[model samples]
Target: MSRRSRPRGAATAAAERRASSRALPQLELGRPTSRYGRWRAATLVLVYVLMGIHIAHWRIRGRTLAPLELNEVMYTLELGVVTAGFLFMATVCIATLLFGRFFCGWACHILALEDLCAWLLKKIRVRPKPVRSRLLLLVPPLAMFYMFLWPQVLRMLEGRPLPTLHLRSDEQGWASFQTTDFWRNLPGPGIAILTFAICGFAIVYVLGSRSFCTYVCPYGSVFRGLDRLSPGRIIAVGDCTACGACTAVCPSHVVVHEELQRYGTVVNPACLKDLECVAACPTGVVRYGVGRPPLLRGWAAWKPIRRPFDFTWGEEVWLALVTLGVLLAFRGLYDAAPFLMTLGLGVIVAYLGLCVLRTAYQRDVRIGPGWLRRAGRVTRFGVAAYAFAAAFVVFWGHSGYIRYHEFAGHRAAAEAVALAERALRAPGGETGGEPHDPGAVPGLPDPTSPTASSGDPMDEPNIVNRSASRAISHLEQCARWGLLRPPRLSDTLRRLYTLRAEARVALSDLRGAIADLERVLRLDPGAAGVHYNLGVLCATSGRDEDAVRHYSHAAALNPTDPDVFNNLGFVHLRRRAWGDAERSLRRALELQPSHALAHFNLARVLAASGRPADAARHLAAAEQLDPRLAQPADPAATP
Candidate 1:
């Protein structure tokens, strides 16, 4: 998979994709789109242009995209903080979901670093590196650690949005756009740039291929599924003639020929469709097409297509992995045999599996709907899904950090949103056969509905009961994944916490949930959702005083969360503090009048606290608002 192990036949097709890659007796590069680097270059300019807008807002405007930010957009799936640079973040996600990783291929800062590293690697001769066994062991853990921590860091973070980076703002390259005192220091940026350059060079050549995209770059991970789900993709048109050109040219080390035979598209997330494979096809069979190809002929040439990525993938970050492997090997030589053997087996299996899968899956003919040539409504649906995911990523990824950083009136801004969105939030019970204004943005067709907001969201084919149930199930699974861990003291502790807290409220042992969450907070106190969870836990425990404290913190963290206010009010009601209870409940009602509980509780508190006229008014109001709420709070009769 290291691009070198590729059968040495594809060099020619790649010559045309990158003008510079074609340069040589040295190293042949990109394919047909080489000329398009003009626009690609322009894209980088445009990204910086957006970055300029972000800087301008931060400095002259003294504001950034709050509403457009991700967490503000989608807290349902707390992916991460979305950049406060709403326009930039929005563009990155929407455009990417729509157009592929044109941003990364053309303008990503990390991609630039990779390019520099590749250039340096070419300047000298070195063997490609191997992946380290130990890193794999740690990655799953690290990934899990970050997942739990992110929501909390999101809760604790001051603000500015994240999954964002410091804009490298020089005339020639990315520079620091943040004007804050923290970014004034040059060391971190300097080290980062240096690290990128070294890794890029090592990865492209000696350290393995496409290392940056596979291992180091965060943006690449974001765009992988986007590219896979996209309707159009670059593909090998016909027989590859067994040329190695495409493989050699791919920075991500993708097999151009294999893509032509399999899914019939370069659905591989790493594929940017630079089209080196088509250019490398000496047999003149390779061509880019819409769907999977019709004629799947050519196993001789099919070997290239059949080669699975399981092999060279670690090479995507092979160099760092190799370094880590060496370290691990050295350490393992003296340590546990089971651990070392497991690690070794994993590495061996990955590489060997890639080789075997490619050979095993190599097909002589293409598969799938032959008529999928045109982009249809499903494609539009795909586009919408991409946009939704992208928008969420951009917003959630960075929003919390903005809150954590605490800019001028940020806390106030959040509270305002919580009061607005939550107080008016539908509370899941809608009666009038679904509201008309479907909340679809004007001009953009709702992938599910051609009409504007008139259609019932639930009635829509995509959002119908079955699909919604499936979606809810999927989300629940994801949330539950937060608790998985090999048994340990931590696991036991988590179980204990859930036994005491989450179980009592939701009738489930949620101590694991708390343990998992607390672990996250330990890593990133500035995260957005941590305080919110703590508040919920406190409320269920009848610790109103503590609940209020956590609720306020949660409110401070994400003003957009409506449930926070509802709970805050509930805590106040539990304390029997009528005035504060009324205020909290009223605020919750304003945000979401459909909330039967808020109305019921407000009415109950009013009646109990010596106000006949007011109590009668509330009693009438609660029944009208929710007839179910007219009943008393008997455990059996409770909502």
Candidate 2:
């Protein structure tokens, strides 16, 4: 019988067999959904809210929050010190070694922000296409080396002492919970917020979610290294239908199914451990468990790594050179702007340069054009490229000029402070024994004073006041331009204020001195020296209450300093708080057995408390330590 004449049931059976034979192996035909993803989203939102609250509190109250960026670790490493941020990063690296790049998928603040950007794009029907370039993988390692390791190596080569591990334990500002001038402790607000936008959102919009991690993040390189040895992984057991669903859902563009099929586990360092593959599998073959060490997998077991984009070897070399050049060119721009912004700017410029070069090349080889026409095309292309290049050069030159002016201002301020400090240190209060000419310092002009040429070096008050005023002017210029945003620059401003206060004191401008000292304290409340100086200034100006408060702060900042304790005692004695004065003076004596001034202060406190014999013993000891205390009796003598 012909096929059409066959019984209906037999025909149906035959059709079913044919359909089964043609069936293709695939993952379940649906979008992968996971409870883990929901959990991650919820956790990330909570973390973001808490961080926002922390930053808000810091901004409003001027308090130090925990250091949150990899740059902080770089800063600590540059100084040969280990800060709390470095320890925090080290802990994350350890966790990566055990659990893979879980943080990248679950907890990283930047990634969370990028995901939000991606979701927004998706809502607008602009699905982000994942971009992968093998050549770009070189960035993270290079960044890590340059940012965190190169400085230490350079210091060593320069014969510097090994970086010290300065664990900040003091409760003033270094301690985790202490209040600080947070705005002064880190980069300026412009750089900080712009960096987040560039790295977290702008990069995502251009290169896809987590592009910063794949191509730029220095800390991600550290995590990638540790993740290779991570035993925890997603494995395919029994059988896995080679469905592309897992790859579709992978934000990192990892070939998840292929990795599992070849090595029986996902060993890609980029694997986020997001669990989407397991959730999407229909055959119940995918699982999460401790596996054989990923490093133990033989080379033969490795799958062919395919990138979404490919480049010729020459292209890769050119790209790498361009990246290195940009990195070198923008080395110190981090203080002025975000490193991400600098890198992004460099990338944009390099890409445009390449495009221009390629256009010139194409124009030179025009097929149908005569030699004259080709020459004209080449000329036009050259002019356009030159103009483009010139624009970038001018931009860079303008930036350099701004930086130079800022540097000059800082140098002038520093020179003024040095001059003032030298006068302050002169023996017998000869503050203006010899005026140092500001013009002598390189890159620093003389203060524009009408009397500068005619001024007498021995005119102590005029010289001190003029130098301090010049310093204040320079620092104020820096502040106005936001050049004093970096921690080092802010500290310079603080020192400048303190120096100006000293100059004010020399000129007997008590109110000006107090104002300058107050500014100093506001900039860096934990500065023990500034606090002590403020206390002395206040006490001399007869503001005993203000003096006591400043003295207490000084004592808290420098608990081991006998001078701080001695001054605190003196302030208490001035207030006639005999009990507090006695306690502070004794603590000062305990800190320094040879504190002769503390002995005298303690004797005064003892005499006031009616302990005449004890007072006499302290007085005898004080006179032995320093005969200046052996004076005619005065019941209200100040220490």
What would the TM-scores of all predictions be?
Answer: 0.35, 0.56
User: How much is the lDDT of residue 175 in candidate 2?
Assistant: 41
Tens digit per residue, CA lDDT, model 2, 1-639: 334554454456446545632442332324334787678888789878987887888778766556555566775665545555667787888888887888888888878887788766666656554544567787888778887789888988999877675655335334432436444346676776777787778777656667777878777888877877888888887777776566666667677777778777887787878787667666878888888656777765333344435334544566666655665455354256655556654544444455444443333321111121143255554565668677976766545554554555576776776676556543221111111110111111112323222345466545656665665675565466542356666677677766666555555666887798788777877877777777766766778888888878888888897767777787788788988988998998998888777777788888888887888888888789777667568534443
lDDT of 2 at 607: 83
List ranges where model 1 is wrong by over 4 Å: 1-33, 37-42, 45-99, 123-145, 148-206, 278-289, 292-639
| lDDT score at residue 61, model 1, on the 0-100 scale | 56
lDDT of every predicted structure (CA atoms): 0.44, 0.65
Cα lDDT of model 1 by residue, 1-639, tens digit? 334454332233223334433432223433234445445556656766875676567666553333222222222224333323334556777776665666667767546655555545445543244222324424333433343446657655866343432333234232223323322212244444444444444344422555545544434555564554454557555544544555556666665545555544455566765555555556756555555322233333223332222222343355335434432432222111122222222333233333222332222111111111122123343344346546744543343222222222223333333332322212222311111111111111222322222334433322222222333232233234322222232333332222222222222223433554565455456655566666655454445586688677777787765556666766776677778877877887787766656666666667667655665666567668756546544312211
How many times do residue backbones clash in model 1?
99
